[model samples]
Target: MTSNATSSGKTVASAVRDVFERIYGDPLKQLESLITATGLPVYKDPKTGALLWVDVRELRLRFTLSVNKLEKFIEGLRGGKLMYTQCRRCGAKYFPPQVDCPRCKASDVEWREVSTEGELVTWTVINVKPASFSHQGDYVVGIVKMPDGFNITAWIDADPKTLKPGMKMRLVVDRRPGEGYITYWFKPAF
Candidate 1:
């Protein structure tokens, strides 16, 4: 069995699929074999020595996000810039790029590129992840306070042991692996 810690440079989804194939051969054939022998999807756990019931149902999801309101923000990432939304009416800024200003109940927002400079406010290491992210190694999620006063939540590419509160950070735009989409993240500013 291949160790999960080995690096393959494959997407998380692809890696997970490979693991399943290796364990079960053909999933359909395995299901049929199990049913013929046991009459149920239940099987003995190889490591835990417990009875495990495999779920028969499969679910796949793909989302088409509407970026009409934040189109400029998305475009900025492709152009290697980090963008944010600021309410023209209330002078409030948003890092996640909100179209509506809840403070003034206004729709007048100005999309603007934000400074790369920021301060790390807080962060956490995601040791437990959802199914979609299970193939990847642990990641750090951090909240950065940009110079414009808005906070941006994004993955922090750094050694967690070296990170500290109020540490300097800088926003960066890059393609997200597995998803093949441009996104922003933060890194140690030096």
Candidate 2:
């Protein structure tokens, strides 16, 4: 069996999948063969004495989440406005808006629009990209402090060399290229 570490630019996930395929041949066929040979769908670990049961089948599940509570926030994004939820009783603000206020334990929350301008607090360039966002190359993600006492994190649309702490940034909301989905980012205000 190959070690957990991968080489030759292969990701650890891909390397682990390759090792499993090499040992098992085909997933379903291997499970059936093991059951037929051992009279049980179980196998002992090579490194440990622990016995493991073979799964009968593999299931891939996708969930559809309901956004009923944050519908106004979504609508605000669609309508070119950034919205947040504020607690009516204690005056606590929430971005990625929640209907319930955890701090005050109150359900009395109101939706409000956030300012389009913010000050850049911090940022970093993503060099090691995840598989899903690998195509975006090395991108800058930053946290900006808004005047409303809320900090928002998003991709920063600017040259890394030109970015500095406390720089003014403007919020932009539009459809992401190639994905055709609405997303927000921060660009240098100056």
Task: Give the number of the best model, judged by TM-score.
Answer: 1
- Please report how far candidate 2 places residue 4 from its true position, in Å: 44
Predictions: Cα RMSD each: 5.9, 9.8
lDDT of each: 0.81, 0.80
Regions of candidate 1 where Cα sits further than 4 Å from its true position: 1-30, 38-55, 177-179
Q: Candidate 2: what lDDT?
A: 0.80
Worst 10 residues of 1 by lDDT: 1-10
Give Cα distance to truth, residue 149, candidate 1, Å: 1.1
**Which regions in candidate 2 have their CA more than 4 angstroms from the true location?**
1-61
- Model 1 pairs whose backbones collide: none
List the pairs of residues colliding in candidate 2.
Answer: none
TM-score of each: 0.76, 0.68
Q: Write the per-residue lDDT of candidate 2 for residues 93-172, one digit (tens) a residue.
A: 99778899899999999899889899999999999875455545689999999998889999999998998899999998
